[model samples]
Target: MTTPHNPLCPTHHGGRCPAPAPATLLFLHGMGATARSWDPVVRRLPATAHTLAYDQRGHGHSAFGRRPPTGLAQLGDDLARVLTHPSDCFPGPMVLVGHSAGGIAIMHCAATHPHLFGTRVTGAALISTTAGRLDPTCGLRAPAGPALARLFLHLTRSRTPVSSLLLHLMTTTRWPLYGRTAPRPTRRACSAMIRSTPPATLDALLRRLSTHDGPALTALTRVPVLIAVGADDRLTPRPHSRALAQLLPHAHLVEVAGAGHVLPLEAPDLLAHHLRRLLPPE
Candidate 1:
């Protein structure tokens, strides 16, 4: 159902005020990913579930303004703006689900705008993400880490066909991103998403993420939170989720076995179940 088109709702809806509705599920994707990353999880949710997944700045259809610095702070501000404006897709209370870099953005938003929690943001699910420090760790440390990082940055800065081809080749190899259980089709879809990311966006987000520090999120304590990580995730592994759980003492932490970094795609059923639990009774 859509809200009527009004100053509150615009021609997109046709009402002066946004219609009250069940809690909305706002899904945020990680770096180098788009709103489509949540497609699998959203498909598993109940038909009546009010859901909205949009490309964060610099990803998917969202334009990346070159003038502004792209980082967690900017992303957080963007999220705040979206929440502040109640539209047909974002009406009333919301349960936010963020993955990877997207989770960091959520934490930043919550930290800066604590007032939004418990009221506008009823709950949150952080999947395969960390508060900050996205560089190589024990779980993901490798001799090629630095080299890969450098290569990625270089590739993302260039818009040449060769650079794009290289990125496509690198992303098409699915072993590093998915667990043993993830189907081939899922990996292909993920690869496509990564390949489609604008080179400029990739470069900007990567540079910021490399130095990102975990955001202080005391505000999250005011609401139900689910901190989930994949046991096999090399990037932002269990330790990261544990730290998040510690930050929010009341959060429920779940480590899914045989899964990798892309929980929304690799384990949609599990994510869908937890998201539903966090939603307010309709």
Candidate 2:
């Protein structure tokens, strides 16, 4: 299932290039995160690398649209569309890099559409994600669950006109990282990403997470897989990643010491190193 060469790719030198073009990297962000969250890691890739990152439905620049999707299928279907969408222009082998919910979406897509994975997807990295048993409570005590989380999301749907400081503080405090302190800018950026999500979208996603059984990932067994998790990640802790690795017995699992849920921002360098391993040698 070879994709036609993308003439516009930098490596396509008048159809006379000596080697096959590098796989285009497609990045998917987790819940409450925008494509912008990938900036740090994308920056670390080679200059000529082909990369694509976009806000998932109801996230960042993308809208929630008429009806909010009730299951992971919609998310997976959305990913399929992105891969095949003509305007996105990814006409070659791909390496999928998904964080958290993004990784879950990838699993659903691969399971539902094995044909697509068999052909174009050559590699994948599932980071800070889980296969099943996602605790949507997010470590909150009993009684302070999804409803309260939705309320918080509602409050942050828009920037507050008065006391914006307090709003930012509230958002930052909820960020699910471990003990190590993130740089001020990274913390602020992550907070802003979460704030951008509409409450409805967040609510729907939380519901989906709570009910979803793990997707059948047999299709992924054909590809090179890297499973990474923050050792101290509280949201989808290391045990979650261990379960995922057990399912994909051949996967390489890396536990980043002291890092947390925000692996893309928290440890971009380590991610960049592993992502390069999936790419063809230059």
Local distance difference test, each candidate: 0.75, 0.75
lDDT (Cα, tens digit) per residue for candidate 1, span 29-145: 887777778878888888677676677886777767654336778888778877887565456888888998889889999989989998999999888998876554324346666
Model 2's alpha-carbon lDDT is: 0.75
Query: Where is model 1 more than 4 Å wrong at Cα?
Result: 1-19, 66-69, 137-170
lDDT of 2 by residue, 6-45 (tens): 3233222344333445587888898878878888998888
Error of 1 at 167 (Å): 3.5
Report the error of model 2 at residue 114, Å: 0.8
The parts of candidate 2 lying over 4 Å away from their true place are 1-20, 136-170
lDDT score, candidate 1 = 0.75
